[model samples]
Target: MEMSLQSMQLQLQFFMHKADDLHSCLVNGQGHVERDALAAAVVSFLYTCQPYFNHLESTVRSTRPQHTSLALNIYTQLLDIYQQLCDKLEQLVLSCASYNLLCLEETEPNSVSHFCVGQCQLGQLKLTTFLYCKPTPYLSQVDTRLYKRMRWNVEKLQVGQKTDKDQGGESKEREAKTEYYFLCYEDIPNTHAETDWGRPGFSDGNVVRMWSIGQWVQVDPDPITETIDDWILCDVPQANYNKLLFLGIEEPSCCIATDYMQQLLLLWKSADSW
Candidate 1:
């Protein structure tokens, strides 16, 4: 029996959830250095694994016999790597010595910093990120950028068939209601994209994905900026019912958005009623 892509993705999701649990465990642990290292490793593993699985799934879905062997090879490699990561995570969890989190350093009482707004390509999504900065290790150095903040668009999607009649005619037409979203991630140097994500043996400067976010935003241009302002920050009709949520910059968030879109798409496709 051939395994379905959905089944394969389910297994991958399980592995990802395990990785998430490991990250949470590390977050509560005392070993700052070790915890951060292991957390980073787990995130790195996830970032590397997804694009390969996506490629394999696409190939399998294409039903090209010539690519079956190649897809299977990739699937096997993914499973092997997954096992290795699971082992490493388990070992780290077992060896962790729990301790209360401590404040490593104290800051000046009157220090204050304002949020800096910036825009960048975040995993194919052109979104703004708010930065919280703090002084660098050197007293005379500029502040380091910390905690990239982004909005996760979530909307209560609706799908339904509409009834309409031709003028003075009994004819009827039926159409399927489906929406599509595309995201493009531009490659930047000195980033993890070198070996972490993207095609297996290809180096494309841009990665495009078919994705949709919750509650689409109608971004009208501001009178002065000409440049489209932050859509999430704007007050729109959906703002009351489907406000965008925020997440701090983290490696896991990369896959999390894709996974969310997958689930939402599945729901939209599978729903029979509004």
Candidate 2:
């Protein structure tokens, strides 16, 4: 146990230094930085560090009883460094256009590149296509059938809107408010697929259900008051009833939120575990 703790401490210190270096790079490379390369690097960093973060969290929890003070100190340090890295990544992602971060050569390039749509997990780093749907009273489980139907309907409506705008000219401008936002995974196999905007593989019938956010989720800035900030997925659904899907993005509007950062901080504080 002593050796394990010592190893964890070394790992944590290494990560802290890495985080500091990354933060400094982002701060220094403001105007002339290569946005795409930086975005890819940030994503790769998150993917690599996630497993270590998970292992450290589990270790801290399991060994707290035996090495209470030391374990807590390490965990606190971990949180501080992790949060700093996440904040830097988020800022970098939000500053550039979505297309700038596109990994075109990758087999499954992310729809929005560095914008993460779901919770982070060990060994999983793929960003998925997602739809912004009107909120229902209850959270509905989306199956393949429903998913296809919804996609078809949304696409048809969008086409119709385009036709109307083309013919009606300025007259249709009043009705041009977008009711939905759709980001699809690029370059799936299919000749008939709409590769320009939507996800691929619709013709093959091997549809991967996309993530959906309710319109009520406040993903965009409030048009009326303009005060509400955008929210990103912070935690996925967990076994505990109290630990439902969390939606929050950190401050400064550029920093990306980590999967467990906000939720874990809340849990640790509430339980007095840190």
Candidate 3:
């Protein structure tokens, strides 16, 4: 069924009114703007209004109207609305990501990055990925520290394990089953092990000193020294204990949001190698 130009104009006007209401609601509460809600509204508007734009374009192209200038004016208005919708979407996405990052600072205060020089390896493994650390019972009542955990996804180096198979009463070699490692972070304060704290940001003479706080680990499925030695150390500072913690990410916008996520308004993209 072919809809008339007048009908299309009415639909466009209705949506334009809705867009105005949305804009007014968004701007009224400047301090307490609901970013996620705004983002959702922008997305919904884009979805709903896309068909109208298509219909308008088709009507303008297919129908050789008597008054071409009036049709062109309506098309221009539709294009302007479409551009505004796109701009709103961009603003909403950025606002939501930034707001989420700010929330993390208060909610997870101990995880923020303190110092950086180029890229830190310790920061790379833990920053943006989800973690699950097994909390151990307090070793002593005097020690009130909580467990800081890191989740590692480590793949087996070889395709399969080496095994012997019987072939015509003669032993033949076969690949063994592939193994995987599930690792977590262990907050060991003495990871420095008598080594000099040579990080060049803050002075040791100050009240706060930089340190190697702990290391990443998984329980040895088989006690192999080589596997144990490959664990990455958690190098951080005593001062950043109360700030938001981030690990493994190279360029984070804030504590919990990474550069990639900041670019796309998604969740923080992990920078972990292993």
Candidate 4:
């Protein structure tokens, strides 16, 4: 069966409608809209993946000799997109937890710092993140810069983990000045946000750290002249929910469809070599 882009778009829209209907009228939950939104996002991902999936199926069904390289490229890109789609979906879910969460009207310095006041806990989304610092300033000491960069690295990740680089590669010959970003801790979801967990990566109700590349995350209990917790960029010159994200820097959040899905994709790639 041939599935063209237009056909897939229709398919995606249909699924979204079906999901939205189920979400609004059929399903019952406090976060059903968020759930429905995620369902639609999953459909969106399939829409993007459909083209490559169709090509893969066609190659299998056709009698003509298949171009192995062409198939591999499409497959690799499909997997990458699938991964990216999951990451976006997770961010949506995490953020949606804050939806209808009583927008903070006070927008005052003292009010924003209190989670219960201007912020709320997201226990289910299970995000592990670091506090990112402001953009490179007039500049500073090496250790400070390195630590800042480590947090930055954690924030830059969208999806994927650090796998050891090829040993034979020239990785060991790196310049002396570079600061190594380390993975501080792996976060475990408590399922309950009633209390603030301590140590490793938990503090002030939320402080989970996972890094990739050189990106900075602000430290917990922000080290500033004054103590405040809301995104500073959001507070300065006044902030609304819409402007907070844009004003503050964004970092990557890694979430895969599932560990098994990752393994399946790898297996599919290995199968292609034969």
Model 2, span 186-218: residue lDDT tens: 122344556546754345553333333222223
lDDT of 1: 0.36
lDDT for each residue of candidate 1 in 30-106, tens digit (9 for 90 to 100): 65687656645644554454554444433332332345786666555444443443344333333332322211121
Candidate 3 lDDT, 213-271, residue by residue in tens: 22232232233543433343312212112222333313221211322212221122243
Model 2: residue 185 alpha-carbon error in angstroms: 27
* Model 1 alpha-carbon drift over 4 Å, by segment: 1-29, 63-215, 222-225, 228-274
Q: What global local distance difference test value does model 2 have?
A: 0.37
Looking at model 1, residue 260 earns an lDDT score of 49
lDDT: worst 10-residue window of model 1: 130-139
Q: Which model is ahead, 1 or 4, in terms of TM-score?
A: 1
- Range of the 10 consecutive residues with the lowest summed lDDT in candidate 2: 148-157
Judge candidate 3 against the unseen true structure and give its global Cα lDDT, from 0 to 1.
0.35
The models' CA-based lDDT, in order, is 0.36, 0.37, 0.35, 0.31
Question: After aligning candidate 2 to the native by TM-score, how far in Å is the CA of 230 from where it should be?
Answer: 30
TM-score, prediction 1: 0.26
TM-score, predicted candidate 2 vs. hidden true structure: 0.32
Choose 1 or 4, whichever is better by lDDT. Answer: 1
Q: Give the runs in model 4 whose Cα sits over 4 Å from its true position.
A: 1-67, 100-274
